[model samples]
Target: MKSLNHRTKVVILTAVMFVLLVAVYACGILISEEAVTGSFLNAKRPPCLEHPFGTDALGRDLFLRTLKGLSVSITVGLVASLISAVIAVLVGIAAANGSKWVDALINWIIDLVMSVPHTILIILISFALGRGLKGLLMGIAATHWCSLARLIRGEVLQLRSQQYVAVSRKLGKSSGWILTNHLLPHLVPQFFVGLILMFPHAILHEASISFLGFGLPPEQPAIGIILSESMRYLSTGMWWIAVLPGLTLVLIVLLIDKFGDHLRMILDPYSAQE
Candidate 1:
């Protein structure tokens, strides 16, 4: 075979990663409570052939629990990130196209949001919203838009200054018409790349908040909950419960982050030529 080029290699790798991630999510969805249901007789069993990840204190299969938890995390992340990305695009466009006062106000809000640490802000928001899935989603979606909004605002401003845009303005095109015909199309790439990049961050935040007891409820099979529960059993020589699942979470995050990078490279015209 002719040697694979860099772009080809990246494409293949990205495809594999995408498929694997989807498979994990699908498996998590396909698996029901029965896969994780407890059997006291098997409680606290160490890793073995029959139970690859062993059983937790309640004898729930750690593997299945981890998958279910991961699925929950991914779902939460996907929804929150999509919301955040939409908020970002809207805020960015508004700031760029609106009056100076409106722009200043939006910028101030962005700065204010960015001023606070994400974890702290998420915790406060999640707590105020009653600390469940809804709250967690709101918290994450509300917090993650600042940076992307700023980027989009800059891009829009630059595009607005271009000769074609000025010509459109001189030709009596309505602002809305110009925006729809010109600006929005250019923003598609940025929007998608930003959305993909935000996924892992959203996932991590969901897990962290849940671990702190302010996101998902304890009964929900979330990775954070699994890890938090494992804390109590770690001292009793049960390591698989936490270690395996924690590692799996990290691996998934890393894979997602890598996939985002690959996607960015593919989508970026400059990068694609290299």
Candidate 2:
């Protein structure tokens, strides 16, 4: 059937994307840190067969550095998005199921958080937490939950009015029982799609905060730090120093974003039919 074929294609694409991501992560882990470190003899080299991404001002291998940085970005994005998604689900369920006063308070908090520019809010939180890995994770996890929470809240509210939910209520099912058995099961698709969508945003924010010198320590070879360092040598005709790594980061972000879109389409029943 057409529907079955479409589903098969979706599954194949998802699997491919997952494999690509895993491969990238594996490369990062397997790459030698020594290979990326500075060497006076190789310093300031341009892109060539021997060094594809070229050597930086300090002779650090840009290719390996970029891969390592990307791996760190992916790791941070994964962890932060997972935490944010969990927070969103919990807060959303509470907002939809709690008393009117509780709902109002949660909604108010969501609105207040959303009112601030996300980058600025994240910076403030990161700074407040002392601007390291923990700070970056907390900042991203705290700020990125609002939109997903709102989505989940709306979904929960709609589900609460469904016929089956009404019947469950009439049959003396407890709120917890209804939520666990009915609501949570129905939310799996939305949860996964939202989680995937959050990844690109989290990665970008982590890079942004680091670029601004408010994230991961300078010792870490984070993508943002690499890009930031490259900015200083751009005027010296070292175009490869910035362009290659920058392009790599952009490419990764785009791929992750496209993967999320594909996932959303596959998970959304109406969209999948189209």
Per TM-score, the best of the predicted structures is 1
Candidate 2, residue 257: lDDT? 88
| lDDT (0 to 1) per candidate | 0.94, 0.91
Candidate 1 local lDDT, residue 170: 96
lDDT of 2 at 245: 84
lDDT tens readout by residue for model 2, 176-235: 899999999988988889999999999999998998999999889999898888888889
Clashing pairs in 2: none
Task: Give candidate 2's whole-model lDDT.
Answer: 0.91
Q: Which ten residues in a row have the lowest lDDT in candidate 1?
A: 1-10
Residue 176 lDDT, candidate 1, scale 0-100: 94
Residue 242 shift from truth in candidate 1, angstroms: 0.9
For each candidate, what TM-score against the reference?
0.97, 0.95
